[model samples]
Target: MFWEALGSAVLGLALAWAAVRRLPHRLPARAMVLPTGAAGALFGAFLTHSALGSAGLPVILVGALAVSAASLSLLLRPAEGLRRRSATA
Candidate 1:
């Protein structure tokens, strides 16, 4: 259980780091990275807990990581456009 949690955390951080790196220059605010990643981690953990029932640590970890990445990417994408529009306005 401890290892599973640790793995999930690491995966979340990695996903967050990747998202931060990939963010557009217009949206490259440090304030945006932490919250987005933290949200992704929490959501991934919750989804893993609900979907996998605690067993199958590997599957749970992968699923959580993927969901976190996807969620972060989807959430940030619209924000990029918004920031661009606001900047130009």
Candidate 2:
């Protein structure tokens, strides 16, 4: 269980990093998803797979729903933005 949690955490962070890197340059900052979502999704997936996998429809449905909601929510957050000033330091 310890290893599983660690793996999930690593996976989540990696996914977020990948998304940030892969996001297109032309997209508005707000349109990009945050990496934390990826991490949360990973942790949620591990939980669902640990013991709840055998549970009935309700369990599966709930897990799936939660994961989807978290993952999508992260993706929906506005990407970070950068601004430029006319004057130099």
Candidate 3:
């Protein structure tokens, strides 16, 4: 269990770091993104483990990645100079 958690966290941090590098303009500060990704992965692992207590580590890791990516995506913003078109069209 410990190894599974550690792996998930590492994966999540790596994913966040990659996002921070690739989408610097869309994502928020590193300070926020880093932790959000980690926490999200932890939460995902917990949830997945609870739901499938005997599931394999790979499954849990997949869950962690999916949730982490989703959480990170929440922090994204529209590209520069793009205004809201749906609200005032």
Candidate that scores best on TM-score:
3
From the highest lDDT down, the ranking of the candidates is: 3, 1, 2
Residue runs of model 2 more than 4 Å from their true location after superposition: 24-35, 49-73, 77-89
Residue 60, model 3, lDDT: 97
Clashing pairs in 3: none
**TM-score of each prediction:** 0.63, 0.44, 0.90
Q: Give the per-residue lDDT of model 2 (tens digit) for 30-73.
A: 23444454447555756687766555534543554466446745
lDDT of each: 0.68, 0.53, 0.92
- Whole-model alpha-carbon lDDT for candidate 3: 0.92
Tens digits of per-residue lDDT, candidate 1, 1-82, equal 6676677777877777766777655344656665666567666766877877875888777777777777666655455446
Q: Could you say which candidate leads in lDDT?
A: 3
Provide the clashing-pair count of each candidate structure. 0, 3, 0
Worst 10 residues of 3 by lDDT: 80-89
